[model samples]
Target: MSIQEKRNSDFFLRPRFSIDLKENPEELLERITTYLKSDACIYRSNVADKHVFIDIPVRKSHFWSPQLHFEIVKVDKNSSTLKGLFGPKPQVWTLFMFVHFVVATLFLGVGVFAYVQYRLGESLVFPIAILVALPLIWLLLYFLGSIGKETGKNQMKELHNLLITIIEQ
Candidate 1:
């Protein structure tokens, strides 16, 4: 958190935050870059222009390790805002989305097949079982994602703290 930090309680998959600071945006970005380069900095980070990417070291990271991506935007000559997102590594996110897509497709396919079987007076046991099961699987995925977020919550906090430190300087 900086002078003012906005917490987005509605975003689930990727928590969002923004901080307002009374400092020049470009100078703030450069200061962040220099701060992240110090020997004492523990997080692995990349600073390019007004954007910063911060992550836990790979050896200490898990599939669900959260990463921070943020940008600085000038609001006035003497003030700027830092907007950030905390999310799963891009690969994990892509895989999660892909799995959800597959589950949805399977649900639709099975529903159509069940309708056809019902029309033909065939037993609804198997298709209905599958249709019932897909939703449960989706729910499981949702819970798993929430669990992952909880698992990485501390690391996300650490990353945010680092940003706050850089911004304060």
Candidate 2:
């Protein structure tokens, strides 16, 4: 299946609208908002495939910034497919938490091993091992994080391009 199809299958409530705009950004936004207000939940507006995903929570608060909560995937002249991808914030947070948990587990295990080594009257192998492993663990985590970000960006870009194609037709 296509990426768009995959996304559609995943979303419980995906309301997508495509518009060809002659008006300015402000007017286009106003028009899109009017159409979106009816749903009052999850809606996507794609103007020539430059997509803006909006999420309206149950409790409305003007103090909160929608941009922070919602993902706005845009496509410009210099934009790559990488720019269009957006990973869900919750999933990203969860991934980071899992990484931290794994790192903590490794540290705890190493500490216990070191304690046992000390009880057996060994040299400073535990400390040396930890010093070497810590940096390696950090490097792995950094690489994973970068990979996730790049994947999300690429997905968003592909989605934007697909949306644009759909809108054009």
Candidate 3:
């Protein structure tokens, strides 16, 4: 079935809230968690400098079609309002950057090595090696990066959930 059709067939409800960031992150999180636990809301966020866009689910179902999604609900518009809520956690970003750097270094090093080997009287072997390996290396890197991003997204979601739980009590 088409995405829209699938969505229409499934249960879909958007959570109701009037979010304002003037309150502290902890307070806001507490309120959100209270709402979530009471109503079993699922949520996602698109964080930005001046605003955070949140999507809260109001349906009661194990599964929802991808097309059955809610638009972003703006929470905050002032950067200062989100100081504690928006900035990257140092450890997470550090690890991510480290992994990215390592992957890039490995790719460049292998590419250069293959090129040098070809130049050192390996005949056309090195060129063929490079042709085969470079694309594969790049593709692998791309996939790995994508996986990392997905992982990060999952982690963020979990963290948000955890924060909600902590604030609820």
Highest TM-score against the true fold, candidate? 1
**Model 2, range 1-169, lDDT digits (tens) per residue?**
1222223332311123223333344443444445555564243433333344543232431221121122233243322121222344445556667887887788877887788778888886756689579768877876765655454444444444544543233
Tens digits of per-residue lDDT for model 1 on 1-169? 3388898894387999998888988888878887788897878898777888999987889988999999998999989988999999989999999999999999999999999999999999999999999999999999999999999988898888877777766
Q: For model 3, what is the error of residue 147's alpha carbon versus the real structure, in angstroms, after optimal superposition?
A: 3.5
lDDT of each: 0.89, 0.45, 0.41
Give residue 127's lDDT in candidate 3 (0 to 100): 52
What's the lDDT for candidate 2?
0.45
Residue ranges of candidate 2 with Cα displaced over 4 Å = 1-89, 123-127, 154-169
After superposing candidate 3 on the true structure, give the runs of residues whose Cα lies further than 4 Å from its correct spot: 1-20, 24-79, 83-122, 131-135, 148-155, 162-169
List TM-scores for all candidates, in order. 0.90, 0.38, 0.32
How many residue pairs clash per model? 0, 5, 0
Tens digit per residue, CA lDDT, model 3, 1-169 = 1111011211112112222234455455445445545545455444343344443233521222111111223345421122223112334445556766876776677677767876786666645665676567666755654554444444435444543353334
Best by lDDT: 1
CA lDDT of 65 in candidate 3? 12
User: Residue 141 deviation, candidate 1, in Å?
Assistant: 0.7
